[model samples]
Target: MMLLRYLSQIGKYFLMWKEIFNKQTKWPVMKNLIYKEIDDLIIGSLGIVAFISFFVGGVVSIQTALNLNNPLIPKYLIGFATRQSVILEFAPTFISIIMAGKMGSFITSSIGTMRVTEQIDALEVMGVNSLNYLVFPKIIALLLYPFLIGISMFLGILGGWMAAVYGGFTSSIEFINGAQMEFNPFHITYAFIKTLIFAMLLATIPSFHGYYMKGGALEVGKASTVSFVWTSVTIILINYIITHMLLGS
Candidate 1:
């Protein structure tokens, strides 16, 4: 039964993607979904991303500075490392994890609550496709989140540079120079791609768990827990796959 449920969830995910592509069939639904997702990304997620990025940038800079005692290590390399870390790993992975905790739980609980309350049944009676209506918006919103997160990460890198300079870890000139040196555009673009994939998984998995929720409040709680755990685990696993395939060890 458990295995079947998992497989069924996977099937639902594919169906959701198919709906996204078949625009003529789902145009009105897609429009609504896109709006909902935009709200989730822009209004709901913006503050948290900003907060996390700022601290992560500062902490990473400090740690990197502490580890580098040798004069051979360029001072500006700290900034470079900060940028690379924020752009490549921190922004995408951390944001996904945070969203898994926040948005994922919301998706699970909202859907589960609707099921427990029989609102989902009302939607079915009204001829509304619950999956397309409820789930698709979340998926679309998450697709936009990573780009916003990428912007947050860029700001965080600037914050880190400011912090490092304040702490005398590196001069302002050296920090700027090192950051510009050896910079590659592919790094940022690749991170965005990885983020898009992660966001989809993060958004969809929780919605899938919540959509089929049975029982009452306790079951709703269980679904929320499962959503968080599974989404976080999946994000980590996918991160590894993308990193190994693209960045490589």
Candidate 2:
């Protein structure tokens, strides 16, 4: 029964997805909406992402330096590990999980509130495809998500470098060598791919929860929480699948 219910929900979600591109909102209106969404979703998120990436990257560096207490081990490994950790997982995957809380909750609650207040119904009555008007802009705005993740990668490496140098863990020169050593360009590609997929999940999953939620004002809050959970879980699952496919040998 539960499985059947889940299957039904999945079907409904896809139906909404299909409708998002139909009965398109006019470009003039949609242009403004898209800009608003980009400001709300992408530009609004930069400060937090940058701050977290910087500190977390530093922490990763510090931890790696502490662990390599052996004279036999090269100090450069600290930089190498920090670079790998930040690029491969921390910047792309972990930061995305964080956004699943921040952005996901906002999307869900905003939409759920609209539902509760009958604003969505009013849109339908006015002949607007609310789904397309609401969700498509978010989807389009989040196409810039990879750019955000790219900034995260750069900040993370920069943070790691600063932490290692200032903490007396390694000389800047040695750390640079390690970071530059055997660098695979593919890792960046992999991270961006994961980021792009996660971006879609972040946009859609929370919108789903908000759009379809039933009940009154209280349900909006509940829907937001649920959306965050589902969004985060989906991101982690997809991260695993993408990693397995792309990096697993």
For each candidate, how many residue pairs have backbone atoms clashing (under 3 Å)? 1, 0
Each prediction's RMSD to truth:
2.6, 0.7
TM-score of each: 0.89, 0.99
lDDT of 1 by residue, 33-136 (tens): 67876886557778888888888898898898888899898788888889888888888888788889988998899889999999989977887777777777
What's the lDDT for all of these models? Answer: 0.82, 0.95
Clash tally for model 2: 0
- Highest lDDT scorer: 2
Q: Can you write out model 2's per-residue Cα lDDT over 25-121, one digit (the tens) per residue?
A: 9999999999999999999999999999999999999999999999999999988999999999999999999999999999999999999999999
**TM-score for candidate 2:** 0.99
Give the best candidate by TM-score.
2
Residue 235, candidate 2: Cα error in Å is 0.7
